[model samples]
Target chain A: MKKSIAIDMDGVIADVDQHFLNLYHSEYGVLFTKDDIAGKTEETLFPEAGAARKFAFTPGFFLTAPVMEGAVEAVKKLMETYEVYIVSAAMEFPLSLTEKHEWLRLNFPFISWRNIVFCGDKSIINTDYMIDDHLKNLDNFKGKTLMFHSFHNVNYNHHQRVNNWDEVIKLLVEEA
Target chain B: MKKSIAIDMDGVIADVDQHFLNLYHSEYGVLFTKDDIAGKTEETLFPEAGAARKFAFTPGFFLTAPVMEGAVEAVKKLMETYEVYIVSAAMEFPLSLTEKHEWLRLNFPFISWRNIVFCGDKSIINTDYMIDDHLKNLDNFKGKTLMFHSFHNVNYNHHQRVNNWDEVIKLLVEEA
Candidate 1:
């Protein structure tokens, strides 16, 4: 069997809190910044938003945000031996998902768009390894979980903590 | 405008060569396997296997092969905005690329079977981004380029080589 890696999108690949804040400002008439969202609970930010607040948990949030540091390099290394999959909670249309795959293709051509997965329940993505920033996701992930340090998730530690692609590659490659 | 991500099947996601090689070895007199067909050049491997080679390159190649890693993630990411398209080159008829897409949906549960593109030339994809393993396809791709790494391509270093999902996430986040 081949080694597989499933990475999260939001805080791991991009700083999606600002995008969510912007989205909330437009969608639910709320205002917040990345700094304000960090370490804060959902109820604290959007006491009235309810389900709309859950939109931040979706893959589209990160898919539409800016890039994070060393994200590209980390994905490149994982693709060499493992079947890299993007298991996110985005529930939008297939067309939008396809566009993000194309963007990844253009910027990181070596990664295969075919293996990408866009779903809410990541537990279904049965893979050998996973890298995620959400403590909830890391807690529930069925595979060997690697904890990616997030700006707000610094306190959520336990599973292996990796700061960059170098550390991630070292952990994954060392196993091989 | 929204970001776009173009995906190719066959060798990128499905092992069409292996599918055909197995079929040929079992049906015809050909005795090639994935290892025999993957690393070697066409001239060295198929001096007498022209018809079989052509069949393999055609759409019949996507018969029941698996999706590569991180394909689901990347697709979900791009699907956030742009029209996610499956631009593939397959056999003309009943060996329909649509069938391959149907199979893909069953495995992925993320991409829609209808969003598939089963054409010969991706030049019409005019997409903002394209992900394909074929080096020749680089000429046909518009916008940025993301090259999938193959074992045969040991020295295949280009401006945009994405061997893993880290590279893919990095590229998408940067572009978004």
Candidate 2:
């Protein structure tokens, strides 16, 4: 039987940090280079206390977020061996659900809609492996945790960490 | 942490059976009494081989489905003790995602969006209890399975069955 892998969307497959960083620069004239963004939490990186809520509620935020480096190809490659399911904690923003759905369809045309999970809490996910940026999601997952590197989770060292799609492929795909 | 209960939307809470019956009569002059529906599968109940695909693809199908008897109250009551999650295998119909989301919001207003899960396969769901109509969903569930009675699953008697929302409450709520 093919082992199943649950992948987080926002900060892992989608370049949410870059999206927020670019938006932060354009919205408030606050510019931070990619080098400056490392090890910073969303709260510390953005000026507004509830910037995530505001940005997520924005109509085009999810639809237009840049895809992470090599995410599209890496996911398709992983499907050869694993039942790769894209799990995104997207329920909080009602508008983002359809937007994320559309984004996945447009960018990851190879991904079947069946493999996409739009949920609120990732704790309910059951898979052989999970790759996520948040501890709240990875900590509770009943699987091998691969902490996808993100500004918020850079300091966390509990789970196996993958800095990019290449690292993920090396750890999961090639190793297997 | 409260024990989680995954509730199927189509046949369990939302009355897809009633919706299809009404639509079938209006669209093709086909009629079936609720009694006539018992012990019949989707293939047997509808004339067309692809009736479910056709009906699900039809615009506003999930949104217009009637709520099963006492489902709203029963789910709300279950939430007091269980983390009631509305789990719908809605990925096959992309058009139905937002529609189902809106349907739940409009009908079960008390249900938080956080408690909703939109996915393709029910196998990945991790919860303490699962209430669904299809064996495909309930059979592999690690949790205690409560087969919500529907015409399609009335004959397959592997799991404990609940004929209506009242029976669901009796088996899950009062028994607890």
Candidate 3:
């Protein structure tokens, strides 16, 4: 059987942090860099809890968000060797569902609809490898976990880290 | 809070049984109608279990399958009054995930992505009403269960039956 890879979307593939920073700048008239909010929660990044929550409910937020650097190419390359699934916890953000679907369709057209999983929980996912940015998702992953570097996860160092797509390709290749 | 309604795909929304019957005819050079397989298992529908399962794995099967009559209008109407969610046990038919998403996009574009759930289990679903073709899905539902008429579920009469979308709309409107 082909080895399967489950990849998170928001931080791992989609550049949600940049989108949030943009939102903060546009809404609050304040410029905050990714480094400024590194290893911090949304409450720390935004002025209030609701301000951060507002972004999730924003229409077209997931669709317009830029893709993470090197994600498209790296995922395509990975697909050649493994069964790749785009696993996203989209249930929390109801508005982002169709936008995320359109985003994946536009950016990673190589991935089939069969491999796209939209759910609230990650523990149900069973794959040989999981590449995600959130510690919460990787914590319960039964497979080898690869922590995709993101500003919010800067403090977490317990798992194997991949800062960029190049590093991801290298680590997976080495494992093979 | 608005009452939430969970709708099933496959036999309930998209007409999978008709699609399978068409495929069986095209593949086996034998004509089989939906009436012939009412209340029967896959083994009874096809020559073997694998033969029945093959249709699900076929590319474009979910995409090409016709939507159930009145599903689009009823679901759209339902959305106006309820927090509608399109729930499907998609994990079992991994190939149908993306195709089902696209099918909904084409047919039920009004339903937001956040309300769409693709999972292996239905027990996790929490809703005020469930419209499904399977007794198993409606059995454990915490809310009112509307059994959509399907050939296989013909014998299942425990729940309130809606033979068509008009009935579904009427029942929901009456509740409102």
Candidate 4:
């Protein structure tokens, strides 16, 4: 039987950091490099409180976010080795649900709609392995977890870390 | 710790058959009674091929679905006895994602966004019990399953069947 793996959307495959940076530049008229967020949380990326959530709730926020570098190729490769499911904690921002679905359809066209999930919590998820940026999601999953490295989650070290999709491919595919 | 229960949205709580009947009436100048779909699948509710799917894909189809009779009261009562989560397999119809979220917010206002789940498959769900109309969903659930009554699922008998919201309250709430 093929092993099932759950993959997170935002920081892992969607490159939410780049999205935040772009949105911040467009909203504030000031461009900031990745260094601005080094070892800092996502919330701090915006000067004002709740700006991260405000952007998340925006109509086109999730739809227009750039995909992570090497994500499409790496995920397609991972699909050949295991059952890949895109799991996003998206019910919090109701607007993001459809946008995320459409975004995935546009970017990861090979992934079937049957393998996509949008939920409020991740503890309900059951899979053989999970790749996510948040510890909240990884901690509850009763399976192998690969923590995708992000500025916000740099302090978290309970799970094996993958810095990028190439690292993901090396650990789950090339090394398999 | 409270035991969690996953509840299906469409045929289980949303009265989708009634919505279809109403749409068929408006679309074709003739009212469709419940007897019209007795022992028939949801796909055959409309005379034309794919009409049911067309209605489902329509923008307001999910948002306008009426809550099943007594569902609010019964579900609220159940919530007092168990942790309730609304789980809908909605990824196949991307448009339904946001609509379902809005529908739940309007009808089941007490349900937190943190407890709503929109997903493609029920097999990934881990809950103590599940109440759903489709066998495809209930069959994959690892815990206790309550089969909500629907014309399309009348013949399925693998799980405990609850004919209505009152029956659901009786079985899960009063019995508890």
Candidate 5:
């Protein structure tokens, strides 16, 4: 109960590929769609532009999206015990933090927003548990790391992989 | 089925107030716990610190946070018909979109990093549906908007709210 939980946005929250697909669609008449890219690499979605290859650290692409199912409730439940923070790497985008904060307020105003941190190295921060969608961060994260399940990310096999916050809370509670 | 889904972090991902409570306990010697604020408001969490005031938006707070319940599967299921994207907004925090992409890759690599969007205005984007916790963006979204439920934001009674994305997809699929 003394541990804290850190979560990631993007794939975990609303939809993940719609933005780029939306953009790609508007630019080119690409018909690959999400399904064509599922179980494949980013290049599958953007074949000619190599856009997926360059997206390793793109900006103005991952803020103020949607919340995953039970994301609000799970955070609510965990907040009951552990300290929660949103250490994100969303700066790679071109928007400012103020713009990002507005999205959170409009979407999840319930969060204190004070305890949030958008750092480059999330592992550098101090916390008890880490729930993210990236293997690099999760692999390096100290304490309990919960790997959020996504379609494109198929290599993660180490930590506990879950699809929702309820499972995340269950794992943390069980550990507690 | 080529469409994608997107979600928000913060209240939609995990219980934000509880995280604050954990930090509050460690910082100001405050003993306010989850039950104390469950279904309550900022007024109860921080009575002396302008409890009546609504929670402010923070940047890094939501960067690395937990995913909500059923959010993963809902996104996964929705991916069956749409390319899921994570579109979020940042305030002043220093988050890296690269790290966010890596995080998503490590967890749900199945989702292309290109799918994530750290943007400012969501209405400008196009999608079949959006599952957000806020109400303002949904005010005039061109696509179908599914409002996520939040205890802190119970005053919203004007929009079409859904308990989860499953219901949202259900409605969309039925209409289609």
Candidate 6:
């Protein structure tokens, strides 16, 4: 059987931290740096939880967000050997749906529409491997977990970590 | 808050039973009809469960299935009022993912990509209403469940049944 890999979008493939920082500056009139957010939730960066959540609800937030460096090439290379699926916890932010779809089409056109999964919980995903930034998603995953590096997840050390897509390719290639 | 509705694809919107029957004829040299599957699982229709499962694994199976009559117009009208989401138990049939996505794009272009959800279990879905053909999906749903008519669910009468999209419109419009 071909080994299937489920990859998270935000913070893993897409650069959500940069988008959040930009949103934070515009919405609150304050400059927030990645160093300040290291090992902290977005809610901690904002005055209230709603303010951070509001940014996620903004239209085009997911679409306008920049892709992670080397994500496109790495994903394409990974697709050659593994069944790659973009599994996102998108149900919570309903506004991001169409934008996320268009973003994927523009960035990773090779990925089939069938490989995109939009859902609330990641626990239902049954695959050989999962690449994600959040511990909440990785903790319950039944497959071998690869923790994609992110500022918020800097403190987590439970799973094997990959700082960039190059490292991701190295790890999976070695496994194969 | 706007009422949210989750609709099932296979039986409620897209006609998969007919497609499976056609596949059964071609694969096994046996003719099968909707009547043969009334209140019975796909396993009963085929010589073995593996044969029926093979049909789902077939490429282009989801894309080629015909849409339910009046579904396009009814869903378009419903989208004007309700926050509609297309939810499918698609994880079990990983091969159908991209085909199902393209099928939706061709049939329901108005339905945004964000509103599309493909997962295994329906119990995790949080919505105000659900229109599904399977009792397994509807029975555990937290909100009002409208059972879309399907041969496999003909014997199930626990939830409110709608024979067609016309009936679905009447029930939902009345509630609104």
Better of 2 and 3 by TM-score: 2
Clashes in model 6: which pairs? Answer: A97-B114, A114-B97, A114-B98
Q: If scored against the real structure, what TM-score would every candidate get?
A: 0.42, 0.93, 0.58, 0.95, 0.45, 0.56
Q: What is the TM-score of chain B alone in each candidate?
A: 0.69, 0.95, 0.92, 0.96, 0.69, 0.90
Model 6, runs deviating above 4 Å: A27-29, A47-49, B1-8, B12-116, B119-176
Tens digits of per-residue lDDT for model 4, B1-176: 78999999998889998888888888978887877787888667667878778888888999999999999998899888798999999988888887899999999999998899898887989999999999999887889999998888877788999989998888787787
What CA root-mean-square deviation does each model show from the true structure?
16.8, 1.9, 10.1, 1.7, 20.9, 11.4
Best model number under TM-score: 4
Question: A1-176, model 3: which lDDT tens digit per residue?
Answer: 67888899998899888889898899889988888878788667676767766886788888988899999989988988888888888866655666777788799887777677787666646678999998888998878999998877888799999988899999887556
lDDT of 4 by residue, A1-176 (tens): 77899999999899988888899888989787777776777567667877777888888999999999999999999999899999999987777887889899899999998899899988888899999999889988899999998887777788999999999889888887
- iRMS for all predictions? 12.7, 0.9, 7.2, 0.8, 13.0, 7.9
Stronger candidate by TM-score (1 vs 5):
5
Ranking by DockQ: 4, 2, 3, 6, 1, 5
lDDT of 3 by residue, B46-161 (tens): 87677877778888888899988888888888888887888887766655666777788899887766677785556545678889998878897777899998877788789999
Candidate number achieving the greatest DockQ relative to the actual structure:
4
- Which regions of candidate 4 fall more than 4 Å away from where they truly are? none
Task: In angstroms, give how far residue B145 of model 3 lies from its true place.
Answer: 23
Residue B68 lDDT in candidate 5: 59
The second chain of candidate 1 has a TM-score of 0.69
> Candidate 4: deviation at residue A137, Å?
1.3
Docking class of 3: incorrect
Give lDDT: candidate 1, residue B93: 34
What TM-score applies to chain A of candidate 3? 0.94
Give residue A12's lDDT in candidate 4 (0 to 100). 89
Q: DockQ for model 3?
A: 0.12
